[model samples]
Target: MEQQQIKLVVLDMAGTTVADQHEVEACFAKAARMSGLEASDEAILAAQGLSKRYVFQLFWRAQLGESHPDVETQVDKSYAIFKEVLEAHYQTQPVFPTDGCLKLFSYLKQNNIKIALTTGFYRVVTDIILGRLGWLEGLDENRIGNDDSIIQASIASDEVEHGRPAPLMIQKAMRLLGVTDPKHVINAGDTPSDLQSGNAAGVLLNLGVTNGTHTVEQLIGHPHDALIGSIDEIINLIEGIKQGRPSGKTADAYSF
Candidate 1:
């Protein structure tokens, strides 16, 4: 069977392209503790690629039950704390891109493949990280810029009604980039929700990288066309596809 050409690549931020350093998870845990909510580490990890506010809402409901009267207030409080912590950390702490991220981006650009960054972060924080990494060097407020920009577009969770596990963000990226066929795109991230979103979008390739939040063992059970330890391996995956090799709906590939 011939494989469809991949015209675009949608990437998840934080754990995928950017080194997460467990900072997001740590902030979530700290917010839960400060808010007097009980959430296990696994519970937090499971929602890795979800919206921040939505994650807080889920935690609140899980802790106090869905019908709890103070669920809204608790969610608000926890989310606010989380935002403060996260924003402050990103503002002060150093920002670093994941290994092989720059090389992968350059290769995709050279191949004339469009790149879109989709994240669970809000626009403000997303801009902060992008600016710090110089990814936004040539980007303006519109976010759609020339080849000088590292990425062609950016789609944030809050921009869509529903975030990861919903496929809305990926769909939005496709719409903005003028890509009509989902089969012509590749969605890559480091969390289960990322794979779920890509699958829901019916993309040709749904890739998972272990260098982020989840490890190889943690991501094996999720739906994915390939699994690698670094984003750099994507270069070869696309090359294989262009050579008429199967890049999807087969055994997962682990190339670290």
Candidate 2:
């Protein structure tokens, strides 16, 4: 069998690789209730793809009149509570990798393609989740080893100059991976912001998966090169692209 010529694969965490949406929402609700605020589901959904600190700031500003009273302190408290909730649930029901995740990752690794993990999660929370999943082994120092076939160049929403709608993270990932041409890379995620980031980064492919909070229709309107139901579909699309098959229209070519 001929090897595919995929250079890099950038994956988003949270809903894309792990199914922690329910847990994340529960934690946010618990934190909001502790602060004597009632956070609506719509509010929580809108806060998706933002850092926990930013989410807390949004809630604090809405509930407490302003982001005053020390926004960092409030963020710290909310995150602490969120971690407690995560630990309680994770202790009994640990988060497992999404279906076909292991197999797909193994396949990509075997093919010697570079893998980059990008997420809106903070380093603290990301560390905990990766540790639980045994992904920490790859994080020795700032650069994860490619010998394991999985590399993470995640830019936390807080760490970057701008999150999502901006392409700094993806650009940094490409630079680190030595991929100069955007056409040699594929960015996969479950949100419109993910597609936007990939598009802004000038990546060759911006793939959106419906496994996240967004519906297929919602993603269709976004600037994604292709929309699929899951990451497994992304793998199939990559195979098709490698085989000289048409992968459908560019995001801009689609009409709503």
Best by lDDT: 1
Clashing pairs for predicted structure model 1, backbone only: none
Residues 186-241 of candidate 2: C-alpha lDDT, one tens digit per residue: 88887778888898997767888776777788678788777766776656666766
Q: Each model's TM-score, in the order given?
A: 0.94, 0.83
* lDDT over C-alpha atoms for residue 238 of model 1: 83
Compared with the true structure, the alpha-carbon lDDT of candidate 2 equals 0.71
> In model 2, which runs have C-alpha deviations exceeding 4 angstroms?
1-5, 65-76, 87-92, 152-155, 246-256
Candidate 1 Cα outliers beyond 4 Å, as residue runs: 1-3, 248-256
